[model samples]
Target chain A: MTERGYAMPMRSQDTGRGAAVRSFLSKSPPAAGRSRLPKVLTGIEGFDLITMGGLPAGRPTLVCGGPGCGKTLFAMTCLVNGASQYGEPGVFMTFEENAEEVAANVASLGFDIAGLVAAKKLAVDYVRVERSEIEESGDYDLEGLFVRLDYAIKSIGAKRVVLDTLEALFSGLGNTAILRAELRRLFAWLKVRGVTAIITGERGDGALTRHGLEEYVSDCVILLDVVAHEQVVTRRLRVVKYRGSAHGTNEYPFLIDDQGISVLPITSAGLGHEIDEGIVSSGVPGLDAMLGHNGFYRGSSVLFSGGAGTGKTTFAGIFADAAARRGERCLYFAFEESPQQIVRNLRSTGIDLQPHIDAGLLRFEASRPSTYGYEMHLARMNRDIDAFDPEVVVVDPLSAFRGTPTEIHNTLMRMVDLLKARGVTALFTRLISTQELHSGTDQGISSLIDIWIVLTDLEIAGERTRGVHLVKARGMNHSSQVRQYQLWDGGIRVIAGAFSGHRKPSAAPVLIASGKPAAKPKKSAKKSRR
Target chain B: MNQSLDNDGAKPAGTAAHPRTHYNLRLYVAGQTAKSMAAIANLKALCEQHLVDQYSIEVIDLRENPQLAAGDQILAVPTLVRHLPPPLKRIIGDLSDSEKVLVGLDIRERAPS
Candidate 1:
């Protein structure tokens, strides 16, 4: 008999009543001092993180979702990832769609189903059952299905199996009583066989699965939902239950593009990543002087709050260029302007961003926030950041988030948390309201930020002149002076004399004492070995 | 008896004048299980009584040819399918109830009248 609730010592991470309830729901009763349960990595992005490794090893996981929710695709990707990445052979037995159709559907994903089959690493079987062809005149069990599945698994020595949409058996056989009992036995048999399995079921109203298969497969349960808000549809996955594991219980927004399924757990990141005390350039020597230090700490998030025409994006562009000039990578996420537009506009400030981009050191990701849902933008940003692995990230003008203060703060916090966890310095520019320059309502990230620089247009002597002030620079002594500044073609530099009652003509580029690049920080020689 | 003989002469005897009607039946089973064998025997007895020499029974075992199950839409075993005698019919289950089987195959009219 299969061991029920195989108790393992709970890890320190598995504390909390919610986790206990989840373990109980997943049917794994916590024994006082058991060891960690082994996990089978699905290799799907963000999925393994939320699953605390992957689905419980050698156990069945029921993936239930509504129509068009990409359940089959999720299962297929898991199988493929297992076979290709984890070196575990898988068997895909689909009851709803034929093997050929499934193969064709996932062809765009670049999954070589046929090649895997030919290599004996994967097997795809379409269990076809029809209601019209056969008449039942006697009591029967589903032994034929078991036989076929056994043959398929043994043919390839499969370690993973997927039964996609097994509800078709009910419609085909028209005998729920017998099928339900047999299904229970099948799940048990699968456990006995010791192959990690995924069983997809259609979501039912008021039930986890249409056929209540959730009752039988209780090791782990994942619910996939495609929710529509306004006109945008976002796919989300939540781990309803996970036995013998401490899983993230949040409804993570998932994306189904050419890539199969990527669950983006917003809370997957923690604030426990090691902190670095090393300071990096603010890109502007004057700003560095204002901070009374070399620059903001590496891995610390810097916020630049300014109104329109205060040159917020320009500041970010300069910072990005400076990082790139230091032979480090920087990523610029412009929500308001396209890459070319931002590049062209920043040229007015004499900031050469094109060369860094051309050199592949600076990458610009520009998109209108209105084009995608908030979570999609976050997911895409995370994906790009993961791929780019930049040392510095700049999000120009956080105001484009276009949400309530709390919502915007939450998003910014998550993004900053993610960046900080990766040990990457982040610079965010926000547009401050003109009425109140230092109001927290206008700039909610003041608490989460390590440095806050506010730019304003001070109307003095009947002329509008730009002013830059360091509002809050944590852990550093800085000048409290509201230094006057100018943004012109040459570059941006502070004008020392403020409120002098005399305004001079725009001066030529006064490059800060052209000293050799600040001595490089001491780090491991193999640092940044990608 | 004399009166019935005079009437039969006038009708030229029912069996001699009427052509034998054909009853084409097919039984689908997964394998040679006890229930499948019983269904076959039960169907044969019913056909002998009702269809006389006018019926032919075809038995299909799905175990040897599983792919054919999809072609015939076979989901359950021991299913009897009536193909001929116009208007096809089907009866599922063990076919233990001869009265229900006869009615399902539309052979009730062939009963002794």
Candidate 2:
């Protein structure tokens, strides 16, 4: 029991209601509450805001990650920092590293662990299990460790306890059965005593945590991981299980430096928002007129859900560039491609986002979802929202939000909350197969979306045709047509809708015909052979 | 870019302990229960083996000093700490096995010089 913050107080299960009714009721309204826990900041950036505060203060939080990742550092900095920054006493018990070893490792990252120990603000307990020196009796418990730890914790009145490498006891100790039982007992015991504890465990191969500590610690489990793509290292963290709180559910990239690890979420919290009156074209002239008043709201969430080769991201870049042209700051959270890859492709579409990137009007960030859980992704967005203060956030391919552990329904709900609260215009592109569309709940997030723009690929009689359709727009009178659209050298154009065709296009990138094929490209000498 | 790692390998070694007299014995227990009774028995056996020559066992069962739980860093039943020894060490569970108590609690028969 790691201090339950919210509770049913009665029921054991969900007896809510039918599908449609529940969907409407899902995601608790942003209600203000009276939770005044003197929460210590996680320093992992955006993490604090999403949880309304940080993880329930003064309790156990298990941070599990694979080897060579940032688990040990994350644990150390908290203690080193909580002691110095918040004036909270901390005790670090290491089953793997001694005081000296712990000190030197974190010293590079700028934590003065050695100094803290010497000053008596922090205590380090290195439990060594040397087989050469000690013989084992299977019937024994870890009372020796308890006493030593008790002494250390008391000496400093430690409000925080970090058992770095919680799995070490299982390997080095003589008994696993007894160790697991004691671990369970230890967590329960820590709660009654009231100390914020962080227990770091080695992630099991092919599993979340090696020892299955997730089943043990109930309050929260933050999974941190380093993703390697083409030799680039991006560290991420996610809240796997957060009891009684709304948290971001995306694998947001984090950075480790002298101040320790900080997770920067790209999701914008719509707080402290200032609306802009400027109505900029999406660089797709035909699609703009069909948008009734033309273009999107200053800080609204614009979603583009479609199949491949429908020019979804290409169109997104044009909007991003259009905003940059007006000198408004914009940040793009790309999940599918690196910024360089995006720049390379956008260049072909004749939209140059790079110059704006250099001019401080735009930024491009890339990450893999498998690196962390959903919360981490939200936190990472929050970090960027704070840093960039962009008037617009373009997350190309919103469908990628569905990554890892099978499903991410809760994550989308939290993300929606973050966007509304931040008041920053967000653009999310989703990938929904045509099959999923026929089955309503397959892509459940569509209804939650403020604006649903579906891009369709029409392969009528073997000649490829493209159409852009607006399914719905809440609070706005938008187009409801399967309008024809095409890509020329510069950008996109919507010609006219077959059923409900009303708007016509003018100027650059305008639609002239309902399903006009793309003009043949000026052949390059090398492409001539093909 | 392999760098030298530290933590267990660095610092002042902190293990060059000094010779001492009147070893301080602390027996840790949750409360005065049957398990504690067995711990006191096991501790007594350990004391008779090594510290009998120059020391005593002060049973600090947690039943008395509940506030002192974290001070000693107790996690489970029947722990023994040699606070008197310069380089203090700990051993948990019942102090039933005398040989383990000698090496773990570090009660070596003072090496004959």
Candidate 3:
């Protein structure tokens, strides 16, 4: 069994009306006390956290889902994890696929089923039943199945069992009356054997399982769903019922890659991360001066919202370059541009990131936002961030993610929470329309942001001028006056004076021409030219 | 019909007749329960009537050798498997319904009138 951190005692409020109704619906009392039910850790990432441990130990868990929702894969993962990670051996009794096919299916996920079988740590038994080949006479019982299962279990001394799609027997045999009785017996016998079991079932119209196997396996039930919103599919898992255990009841988005299924318990992370007061430079000296002579708070999330071509990516790149130059690892996520494009574009602004890339101080992960769903993108980013373990993280143009406003906000919040929990400083850029820029509405994620920097393009006297301003900086004093800045070849050069009187069309050309001399006042100013 | 004959003594006498389509049947049972005994009696009676001198019956008790259940893909007790036919077939139950048993064994049309 996997160790759990929050094995909460049974609450008194749970014994109220809701518990009574649930117990009546399940036709059993909620397993007596709040004494923690033993669980078998699945070893899938983020799954044990949500279940507080895993499936109820020495009992069957019904995993039901529609076709291709990864029911079999989930069961196989648990069984394989049990045999490999845990010392307990397992037996996979497949009714839908043969032993070789099951082995081959999970092989891509790095499970060596054949090797495990040969090592006596695992067993695979494929129960072949064809209705066309068998004729039913007067009376019969499924004792032969019991005998085969018993023999297989004893042969391997298995401590885990997976009956992948046991409902296939209903179609293979003409006797449902007997089959149902035998199924009940099988579950009872499984519990008696003291081995944790997983039984996969197809989703029915109204019930959890097509054959109503959920009624038999009352210990635990999980529902896997594949929902599509705007044509983007995301797999979700929910612990529908855990008789004696408290589990996360929310539908958690999960991912199935070569590494197998990993459920992202997004809501498990609260706003409880430890805060840091260390300061990090903004890479541009003038911008640093505007941020109270220091920079963003370490481990804080910074948001840069601006209109089109306002140099959001450039600023993000400069921040990443600065972090890398300080010998800290930085992970830069490019949503709209490729890594080569970013490196080349930043090179023109004198922020060459190729050297940092070569030195392994900065890593660029460029992907089209449409390439995956929002949850998938988050999961991939989470995996990358965990792998890289960067000190500073940058996500350029978060608005490129195509989703509803709420979805975008939720994804951003989770991303911010992820970085903050790791005590990593994060900078995220959002490309907003000109109207939203003026209104200061950043898709409702502003509250989660620590530092808000808005960059706008000022159309004055037929020349496009760039202006930068600080909207809010939590826990520190920041320059509030809107400052005019020019994107020079060296980098961003904040003009010496604030853009107070520079909004006039007549005053625009003087500032544009004096951009070279105006940047000379700052002591740490670079030799910049427009 | 010699209903008292054991499974070994129930082999077809004089195999020289009807050599091309000899019926070979294997009856799978958990033990000598009432259902198993009824299935065995029904199977022997039906064979004596339709497949006289052209059939052999082999009874396997799964209770004695449980591992043998997977070989024949047996799930239900009192199962009758036909092995000699080109396409194998299994009839599960007490075999009290001789009509379905004959049809299942592909011998209904060839039954001697």
Interface C-alpha RMSD per candidate, 1 decimal: 4.3, 4.7, 0.7
Docking class of 3: medium
Tens-digit lDDT track of model 1 for A163-222? 987898988776688889889989999999999999999999899998899999999999
Better of 1 and 2 by TM-score: 1
| Model 1 misplacement above 4 A | A1-35, A129-134, A436-439, A461-463, A496-530, B1-113
Higher-DockQ candidate of 1 and 2: 1
Best model per DockQ: 3
Error of 3 at A334 (Å): 2.1
Off by over 4 Å in 2: A1-33, A36-39, A44-74, A100-123, A129-159, A163-285, A368-389, A399-414, A431-443, A457-465, A481-483, A495-530, B1-113
What's the best-to-worst order under lDDT? 3, 1, 2
- C-alpha lDDT of residue A256 in model 3: 84
Residue A222 C-alpha lDDT in model 1: 97
Which ranges in model 3 have alpha carbons more than 4 Å from their true place?
A1-35, A501-530, B1-20, B109-113
* lDDT per residue as tens, model 3, B1-113: 33335332245533322345888899999988999999999999887766877789999999899988988889889899999866788999998877678678876443456
Range of the 10 consecutive residues with the lowest summed lDDT in candidate 1 chain A: A1-10
